[model samples]
Target: MDFFSRQESARRATARMLVYMVVTVLLLFAAVNLVLYGCLWLVGHHALSRSVWWWHQWTPQAILGTFLLVAGGSLLEWFRLRDGGRTVAEMMGAIPVDYATRDLAERQLLNITEEMAIASGLPVPSVHVMKQESGINAFVAGLIPEKTVLVVTRGALDHLNRDELQGVVAHEFSHILNGDTRLNMRLLAALSGILAIGQLGGFLMRSLTGGYDGRQTRNPVTIVWIFGLALWLVGWLGLLQGRLIKAAVSREREILADASGLQFTRNPEGLAGALWKIREQGSWLSGLHAEEISHLCFGESLNMQRWLATHPPIDERIEALYPGYLARMRQRQKNPRPAAPTAPTPPSWNPEGTLGFASTTGRFAAPDKPLFASPSPDEPIPFDGVFSSGGLVGRIGELRMEDLESATWLHRQLPVEVTRALQTGTGAKAVLYALIARFQPMEPARLRALLADRASFASWVEQVGGQMQSLDARFALPVVELCLPRLALSDAGEVTGLLAELNVLAMDNDHLSVFEFALLKRVEQHLRPKPPLMQRHALESRLQPVAVLLHSLLAFSSHDEAAIARHHHQLMSELCPSPPAIPDHGLPPLEALDKALHQLRSLNPDGKRRLLDLCARAVESDGILHIREYELLRVIAGLLDCPVPLLQGVIHE
Candidate 1:
């Protein structure tokens, strides 16, 4: 499905859940009323006549009270989990994976995650390992891409080979891209509310029976006893309904994820093999809260009733991956045969007309030629003005085997020092400082004075500045992206301090260069603990703000006044047909541009697409797409939650 379809699916799932919740609440209301009527009737049996009507015992207040109780409980649980993916990860006892770890397996996991993030054009999610569990399971959790976290079991790392591990990781990434996490979290919250009803019943049963006090209450009518029993039974029924809902939603998504994983690796056997391993070994978790998140796991956490299994059965999943395997297995069972022993082959890197691939060894081989080469100025630019907003959204989390291969190639091509620096907080901070210094060099006297008080930080920056300057422009953003996870390890205060220092250094010359602004903005976007709330605005109402952004972008694209005016006119005609008076003032300051972009972000998805189309027009108006301009466009597209893979491909080509 495309991105738009996935989003629609999520909305539909939410609607379906609401229907289920309403039905559940109604059932609980009836059940509670029945129990209350029975209790009241028995309680008044000795004082009232036998002919007293049963309907007289029923009270609207009782039903209303029960409905309110269930609704309030569910809302409380949902609100508690609003913090999103991290809360779910903690519930599963997942610990963050250390970037500086020396463990080869963990290092491999980090490397694979990095490649996947780059290929998919997303910020790298935090990786967590469920060290306590020895189950071959993994999952992705988060309300959105930026807050997403990937969790895997220790057993998976221990048992799965590199190819199998990559398959599993890719499967989880599919959930992230497909917008499944938000739906999954919603299901979790809804189920939590239902379970609370059951728990309340259990508590009532225990209290009424005097199970906690070791003595029963002497209520001869047995009214309270029947009421407690009814509550307990109804509560379990709610639990059953929740499991069924989870099973229905999770089962279908698992199949889709399996297929998407194959698309990511271009190796069906990789995922099929992981499933086979899970079957042979076990995917059962020994944790206390395992069943609470059974639906979120890579495989079923409990050997639940077939109708309530969160994931489809292993044989069925494997069959979906490799059709006719089950028939072949049955035939083999009918006629037993000895397995043949084959010689093991060493993994070799192969690259033909297709993208490069390493054999099962999982080692990435450097390509014979650069995977991407810069297009010469005379090359025919691949500019297609027809923009499909849905198509672009679909590509947001989409990845092909070729993209993965390219990611591997890019990772290998990065400078060794750059790679090392990304593994530690101190080094990462220095790298950011050096990147800023490259754009805004300070005078010797000022530089000496700035260094006087901060000896170590200044020395590190000076040492890395020259190296960072010599690096290719294409690698600059990716290097900074790679450093983010480690930099994120610092406390919030430390990040604030770093941002302050960067601002000071960038403003040393009293102006923010385009590069400086883009770099700082991108860094701040990721480093902040939470993103600003996304507000929606109508397209017609946002015309002037859109024009301001386009004008600034056009001005930044070229120094030639004619080219700038030409692009501005084109944007105005296309985006603002009525043609507002063009502001004759020079380019807006960085702060104004930042505010304009932030406001533009409030536009709905379709509105954002139009804005991006205008951006594409502005960049290409000069007939030369400079690398800096291309990078700037990419940063903007990413912020807008639109992936411009086609435009990105043109630049890489």
Candidate 2:
């Protein structure tokens, strides 16, 4: 989906959740009111009275009190679950996850993650393993992108091997991508609120039964206390009802996650095999914390009443992914593929600027570069040309200007169908063409050149076409890196950063393999800028020593780590300081910065000052100033902000 559609879906989902909350709250409010009146009528022998005074004196206050109890309960549960999950991770200990320790199984997991993320255009999520649990399971947790976690069971990591694990993690990533994580978290919080009401009712009953202290009650008060006791009993019953509702919500989410995971990975057998192994192993060692997070896992983790199971049966899950999976399983007594290979180690990049530009001369280039020369100096770049030059344009407006005068109109006119097709296409070249076609009416000569150029577009077309026809059709995203040498060849930093962004985007929905990344460097050489020797040197010098230190602190440091780690983080922060991370609390500033970033990500350089003006907006998002969050935003701005000089260069031409 294009960015806006994803946002729209998220908004609609959130709105639905709010409606659910409103209806639930209103029902609870009415129910509490009934309980209050029923007690008053029963104890005082009062006739049914719906007097205004009765509401003012009792019902509203009781409803307000119940709301407080629910809110408090939710607060308690949120902290409890968050802390509990962390403790569980700690107890499991850190399973060694460096590049060196990964065997073929682990390597495959990482590569799949990279490929999906890049393909989907999102940040690469960090990977984690639950080293103890032998059951096949995985869960994603986190409220924000930076804090999100993907945890898999030991069985998933060790027992299933590479392909199966890829299927599992890919499934989890789908949940993260689909905005389900937020919904899942909200569901948990709301359930906590419901349970709190029951707890309050129980507490009142116990208090009445305990008998009031001599100093605390009069005869009349004692009589009222008797009514409280009856209400407490009803409250206890309500708790069970609340629990059932929570479980029902969780059960539906599991099935949805399963289907969505299949949609994302596009490999039914991979997920099916993982499920098969889970059933065969039959070692369901339920984690102590499973009850608290049962909703988040791949399978049923909670030992519910058989009727209250959160997940569909394992067989059902398998069949959904692979029709007649069991029948096929029976036929394949001999292993289908060679014994699963050992996980390969991730290669260490020489952090220095040594890596050469990959060439696209033969097998590696994408098939969709614009065939004709760039727009003539006197003419504006045509929208069609801009679309054809998908890899070239860094900003959205730069590609859209010829179509309309305003960005708003351009946003409205976006061709959703074309974008969708391009996004789902098998080859990057086809995707690139689709993206262009979506934005601008076709230009025959430009399309022809895009399809026919021997030295540039032709090779990419031939390779992508073949790949599309193959049994395992897949887009070669890294092939786009070949164009880096042609467009931003003179600036090594720009080329590296651009390639990294594309690489990250490719793996956004899947894992990016080191092989894919390496192969990209080779392709960029032949089809792009520089002599053969320069391309080779460019690839070799990529992992420079300085770059290694820069990335070491910049990319992975967590919020909690401090001292030297903190200093390195701070230094890295200073290196590219631009703006602060805005909390979700503020509005206008965030809205402006968001608009600016949208333009930048689209590759448009126009009106960048508008982005800088919104820096203050980001700083105030969370209501309170957090230095760390601010620093994070600053880091982002630094990376996306193009210097005035670069903009000036474009203008002068």
Q: Which one is best on TM-score?
A: 1
Q: Residue by residue across 50-102, what tens digits does model 1's lDDT show?
A: 43333434557657666666767768867877766777788888998887666
lDDT of each: 0.71, 0.44
Q: Tell me how many residue pairs clash in candidate 2.
A: 84
Residue-by-residue lDDT tens digits, candidate 2, 159-200: 665456656766776666556566666666666676566556
Q: Compute the lDDT for candidate 1.
A: 0.71
Residue 471 accuracy (lDDT) in model 1: 66
Weakest ten-residue segment in model 2 by summed lDDT: 643-652
Per-prediction TM-score:
0.86, 0.47
